[model samples]
Target: MSYEIKKQRILELIAEMVEIDVNEVKEDSDFADLGIDSLMALELAVYLERDYNIFIKEHELMNLRKVEDLLSFLKTN
Candidate 1:
């Protein structure tokens, strides 16, 4: 799939995992700002690896405050 499509899917996944609405997700949206804590992030990481085969280090997740940042990281790695 194209990066844009994947980006949208990632957004949906994040929203679902966080128990939020998908429309609430934005490129500049910060996870913490959306009430996503480390525990939630860990869960998100597990889902990503399991469903998308995208592995992410816990430390790296610290830098993933924004949706755009995560997408950029995924695109690069």
Candidate 2:
């Protein structure tokens, strides 16, 4: 899939995992700002790896400040 399409899907997945309205999610939205704690992030990481077959380190997750950052990482790795 295209990068943009994959990015959108990642955003949608995150929205669903966090139980937030997808409309409320933005590329610039911080996970913590959206009420996503470390526990939730771990859950998200599990889902991402399971759904996309991508592995992201927990420490790296801390650096994922935005949705685009996540997309870029997933795309490159």
What is candidate 1's local distance difference test score?
0.85
Q: Which consecutive 10 residues in model 1 have the weakest lDDT in total?
A: 1-10
lDDT of each: 0.85, 0.80
Model 1, 1-76: lDDT tens digits are: 6778878888998898778899999889988888888898888788778877889997898988888888898898
Model 2, 1-77: lDDT tens digits are 57777777878888887888888889888777877788877787887788777888979988887776777788797
Clashing residue pairs in candidate 1 (N, C-alpha, C atoms within 3 angstroms): none
Q: What is the C-alpha RMSD of each candidate to the true structure, in Å?
A: 1.4, 1.7
Pairs clashing within candidate 2: none
State candidate 2's TM-score. Answer: 0.79
